[model samples]
Target: MTAFQQQLLDVNGITLSIYSAGPDSGRPVWLLHGFPECWYSWRSQMTALAEAGYRVYAPEMRGYGDSSAPEDVAAYQILTLCADIQGAMDALGHTDVCMIGHDWGAPVAWHLGLLEPERVSVLGAMSVPFGGRPKRPAIDIMREANVGRFNYIVYFQEPGVAEAELNADIERSMRLLIGGNSDVFLHPKPADAQFLAGLDVPTTYPEWCNEQDFAVYLRTLNKHGFHGPLNWYRNFEVNWQSTEFLAGRQVLQPTLFLLGEDDPVGKLEAYTVKKMGELVPRLESHVLSECGHWIQNERAGRVNELLLEFLGRHYPRAGIV
Candidate 1:
């Protein structure tokens, strides 16, 4: 743990702040964190992975933490996100590595399998499942699904609106979003619901989430703001347009999909499971009971165990280059 080192690496012209541990000579594992979270999201799982004979590198994606954030909405497109990881591979001098993503990061890993199939030895995604591209533009589809304010994706479509409201009270907003400060939407959401609005900020965070973890996100988001994170939603249409060539394509890499049974992702689990078997060719699935969207941190012990077992089963130490 104390051996972990934080440094900056230039990938595709974007400088990313990356935290890495374990032997440099060991097989590399790219640990990616999703929206509203930074590299710290992977903190709890690092030690276990490292001990299991893995070299883990968790990078604060562009627009999060001290990483370079491009202002152009086009910059955050899925292709660019894939390129970021490809560029990181190039910079690190590795032809490919096991790609593991949580939440928003899951899409990045899944798309990397599509865009650069050879660069990923295996794919492990959490919370979000890849059921292939949406039939139409995601935002348009989502907006139509819930024309009311309940659509957070649509709410994020507008740039400054979410930033101002979210940043006004960073601590409170984070407490609700990740810290479990309040579960306003614990009940079925209203027709017009806002993620941050009407949520109470509690003095304590969730049992799994600690003040130290909350503080890390608070400091990072307070500095960079939510514009970059929300930009991911803004690229829905463009990402679809760019990846149209991959309409029928499936992930050829061995895939591992894990999620919290209680996570909204469960709604699509059946479809995703079927899709994976159809397109992925090699797939494994697991759903931890009583868990939520934050699967990695929520169940760090099991995640590490699953991760090591998967890696050892797929790319054993003796086989690693």
Candidate 2:
């Protein structure tokens, strides 16, 4: 396996810790991790892609791990997040890339498809699906739809509220969230309930994540706290309003969408997948049965297989220098 290299890059006015592998001359494949996860989340995929002769660049995205966590809530806006990756690509001297993202990282990857259609040669996303810009802000829609219920996104709107609860017990928080059932996010809770209320931390780590893996996440979040990550949820409205020009835009790149059968996010986004054919003209999609939200980790071998096959078809590593 190619040894991974780590570096801190100053880009988009902040620093990002990037973990890369494979030959520098191999075609670049940028992996963007989602909320509460660092570059380490892509460990399995990075190794697989690197071994296949693809340069894999996975960054501890802004607001997580060793990456700079800007205090301003507005700083976590989608445009800025996408800009960070864009700037990184520029600094690394890669003009074209195979971009892939998971969870919150999915939105950034989707928007990058819109923001830099030509540069993102092919796109892959897990957990989240892009349905194009909505007519109204997502916060307002979520607010109304989840009225009289504890929607995590709405609960995260008020500054410092969710942060306090999540930061209080970093380990417990990570355990409950990473190993918790997806139904918790789908099922209605009392409007005033806290994020971690009623959820029990698992005594044992999920089969997908071992003690060493859990340790990395626990230590990373403990160091930075949940403030920066929660701030990501706070910027829904800002992202919606700022991307008005992208209202009808479609991701022209060859795209792949993967979701777990049991992922509540997938259930919530079933409509998007149905209509995705219109937005993503050349698209391939799959749903792994019995899997949950952490698709890559919970189903790492399968996820890597799918990703490598997709890249092999559309972004093959045979020719690039």
Candidate 3:
């Protein structure tokens, strides 16, 4: 396995700790991690993609890892977050790149491609769809749709709720989110007693999670806390208003969407494929059977295969435009 090299890049007033792989002269791939995750989330992908002859860079989004996190809540706005991606690209002298993001990172990737199409060559998203936020804030839409269980998004908007609740029980919450417990919640009814017993039980879940990997994420957030990351949820209405300008803009770039069959986002009646296809016409979708929200970690081999095929087809090394 090729070892990863870490570097510090100062872009847009934030210093990002970048994990990079592959030869310096190769085309670039930018991997963006979602909430509660760090650049470490893309560790497996960086090595694999680099082996396939592409340069890969994964940045711990602001507030998440060794990256700088500003105290102002507005600093976390989606637009500002999107700028960070551009700044990262410019810092590396990349005029265009293949962009891949998971969860919250997906939306930022979408916006980056939409607003600055020339800078992105292809896009891949995991665990999230591309319909954009609803006309109303997600809270209002969820309330109207009667998805009472979606209260978590609203809870995140509340100042200090996520930080308090999630931070109050950091280890368990980390285990739950990163352990793929979101899969347990996706079931139609209460999971079997065995399922409940499966969680927080024997602690074997940490097998896939290394101590140093988890520490990088836990320490960063535990130091800055989750408030900054949670601010992404608080910007629902602001994001809606800002993104309205791109209402008709679809991500025409070669795109791939991967979701765990058991992902809550997939199970939601609102995230239907028809809706997804309408918003992103060129999207190729796949649902990993039995996989969960953390598709990359839960089903790394399959996820890597799909990514390889998609990237090969769209960003082939044989030809250059």
Candidate number with the higher TM-score (1 or 3): 1
lDDT of 2 by residue, 179-285 (tens): 77875576677999988887767788889889999898887787789999988898888888899989998889999999999988888889987888898999899
In model 1, the worst 10-residue window by lDDT is 179-188
Pairing residues by index, what is the TM-score of model 2? 0.98
Model 3 Cα lDDT, one tens digit per residue, 189-238: 32122212245523655555776777766776776677778887777777
- Residue 117 C-alpha lDDT in model 2: 82
**Model 1: per-residue Cα lDDT at residue 112:** 87
Q: How close is each model in CA RMSD to the real structure?
A: 2.0, 1.1, 3.9
lDDT, candidate 3, equals: 0.76
Model 2, residue pairs in steric clash:
none
Question: TM-score for all predictions?
Answer: 0.94, 0.98, 0.89
Give the runs in model 2 whose Cα sits over 4 Å from its true position: none
Q: How high a TM-score does candidate 1 get?
A: 0.94
Ranked by lDDT, the better of candidates 1 and 2 is 2
**What lDDT does each candidate get?**
0.80, 0.89, 0.76
Highest lDDT model number: 2
